[model samples]
Target: MDPDSVSTDNILLPRNIEIIDSKIVNLSIILFISGYISKVEISKFSHFRELYLLYIPYKFKLLLRGSRDGFTPRKFHESCDNVSNTLTFIKVKGTEEIVGGYNPLRWESSSSWGKTNDSFIFSLKNNDINNAIISDIENSTYALNYYSRNGPRFGNDINIENPNSQNENYNRIFCKKHHYKKKIRDSEEDFSIEDYEVFQIIKC
Candidate 1:
């Protein structure tokens, strides 16, 4: 072995990836809606799809009505991007915490408001982005998972109101909201960076 020879290790990843202004190839339509990023090879171009990104309404609110197209996950851009076995975060920072659950709304629609082919994209019909599934990450006050909120009451069509008096339902989940008996200091000193990171996610 040559003593002068040096070894190099690539350490620029697995922390947080950033998007430089230059790499904005195809503008992401469902950028916030879809979750992560992955890579794949096809016959020709390095095509991109709804790879990586997952449905965490914290990013959006529970904008849709049901779960992932009937409580199922689909491959957004199959042949082109070919990203599989990827982990998506419903959390998008303020801290490293993430919110988790099968996004109840995303699965209800085609997950797409429209249709698409190779070199382009589109939207699904009735593109109503008014999120019903409010969470602490989005509203930052209250939240309940699909199981917690999924009942006959939640399925009722939204009734928006601006009452003249003090009698109006403040569109919410859990009939009420979480009343914590004690305040948990989020920045607990004994926690390792990664420990607190995972703990922060609201696991549904």
Candidate 2:
């Protein structure tokens, strides 16, 4: 079936939401957070199409397996479900905040991506690239570390809880574990979210 010919009637959109742009590409994801929404254009980046095609064959097989299988953590295991080597866009509530990161490797429950030190995270307001704050990640462990959880810890953003700090909104892309553990430790910085959406990054 032609993508352009597909109907979006089944696609859920919140009431009272303004349509930003009607132009549609191969993969356009509209993420709604607290009634506000943002779009992620798959064609804007690079190399997403090739990766997505690679997933198609596997996806057919996965569907077959799922028919026989009873359960799986499909939501949490984004990469395992076929969104490998993708960028996750997270939109948070308040101050037009957005925070997200890229996972360069496929997520597997058995391997945990094997100490991927190259992974990174970034922050932006109103989806403005000029106002973006890109940070190289120091750690990329699961939200749980058996003893202590570790994810992307930002600067001045304390991992430990502090009553005095005012930045209470926690916007993080946690992998396979709890979102409350790993933190971005920038006190002066704040990217809090009420909710978010995850899309498979595919470059056109």
Candidate 3:
């Protein structure tokens, strides 16, 4: 299995939805709110910034995991069934909507990917499923860059990440409610979903 780098040959007009809540602190009430702090009513601070290919892996994994119960891979894909393959779980709706990019401006690739996730599977025995997951991530991301329409070529833009931006208000509240309780600051470990002891926000 050959790992492909970001393809420079195509029209890499890659855009990302980019969410803020880097980690869940309290219950979903407040989130970390990536990039900047909120100045307004926190709840109304919803801003979506369109970033080019930056630390995409970091941003993407954070955004992906933040929505999970505890950022666990299984939690990310609820549609996975107990399959007989070497890799038991699969990303059921992994391809759908690419969702949230519903803005009438950019081209939506997520919808197409969601449609493809069903067919995309990596058998651990055949090609190292973990590796495949990584590959798929890259492939999916790279594929996003190629999508071009209406001469302008838009990326699947959406509101996420920034709190002050008119789009990610809810996310800001989610971050403040979920700040890392331990405050164990180390350069090596920033403490992600796995570090958080509690799964559900309120232990209902």
TM-scores of the candidates in the order shown: 0.17, 0.39, 0.15
- Looking at candidate 3, the ten consecutive residues that score lowest on lDDT are 96-105
Which runs of model 3 end up more than 4 angstroms from their true locations? 1-68, 79-141, 144-204
Sorting all predicted structures by lDDT, with the top scorer first, yields 2, 1, 3
Q: Write model 2 residue lDDT over 35-133, tens digit each, in one string.
A: 111222334323443332233221111211111321123323432334344444444545466565545554443423334555555556665554555
Top-lDDT candidate index: 2
Question: Between the candidate structures 1 and 2, which one is better when assessed by lDDT?
Answer: 2
lDDT of 1 by residue, 1-204 (tens): 679965333222233432211111112323322332111221111122212222222222222121231211111111112221111122212343322222122211121221111111111112221221222222212211112112111111111112231132212311222222222132322221111000011222
Identify the runs in model 1 with alpha carbons over 4 angstroms from their true place. Answer: 1-32, 36-46, 50-124, 127-136, 145-149, 152-204
Q: Count the backbone clashes (under 3 Å) in each candidate.
A: 17, 9, 29
Model 2 ranges with Cα > 4 A deviation: 1-74, 78-82, 110-113, 139-185, 188-192
Q: Which residue pairs in candidate 2 have backbone atoms (N, alpha carbon, C) closer than 3 angstroms, thus clashing?
A: 48-202, 48-203, 154-184, 154-185, 156-185, 156-186, 156-187, 157-185, 157-186
lDDT, model 2, position 130: 49
Task: State the displacement of the C-alpha of residue 70, model 3, in Å, after optimal TM-score superposition.
Answer: 2.0
TM-score-sorted candidate list, best first: 2, 1, 3
